[model samples]
Target: MHSNVVGGSDRIGEIIEVRGADGTPPYRVRYPDGHESLMFPGPDCVIEQGSATAAAGRR
Candidate 1:
């Protein structure tokens, strides 16, 4: 996800849980830095299927 904060770089993380209905928004993500957050992605965010598996492989 792209950070809205000025000077913040893009964030990469794996979706650990889904809080939305029928696999919608409000995802629980775990970042490479070992921090997790519940995210309601904005317009800057890109959703990719199977990206979570790829992210896990990188860890």
Candidate 2:
């Protein structure tokens, strides 16, 4: 997760399906084993995937 509130937080993940009314809702990400899990967001939440792990040093 990175900063989102102009000082808030932002996260990255492989999107599965965006569910909700305004398109802001929970997401599904694939695990290392190829299994997926739901990433539920709170009210007025948004998600974005950015730079690769290699570039972010997450690799």
lDDT of 1 by residue, 33-59 (tens): 899999998898987778666757866
Q: Could you give candidate 2's per-residue lDDT for residues 1-59 as a string of tens digits?
A: 35447866455456556766676656666544567777776645545565666435634
Residue pairs of candidate 2 with colliding backbone atoms: 2-10, 4-8, 5-8
- Each model's C-alpha lDDT? 0.87, 0.59
Off by over 4 Å in 1: 5-7, 51-59
Report, for all candidates in order, the number of backbone clashes.
0, 3
* TM match of model 1 to true structure: 0.73
Per-prediction TM-score, please? 0.73, 0.40
Instruction: Itemize residue pairs with steric clashes in candidate 1.
Output: none
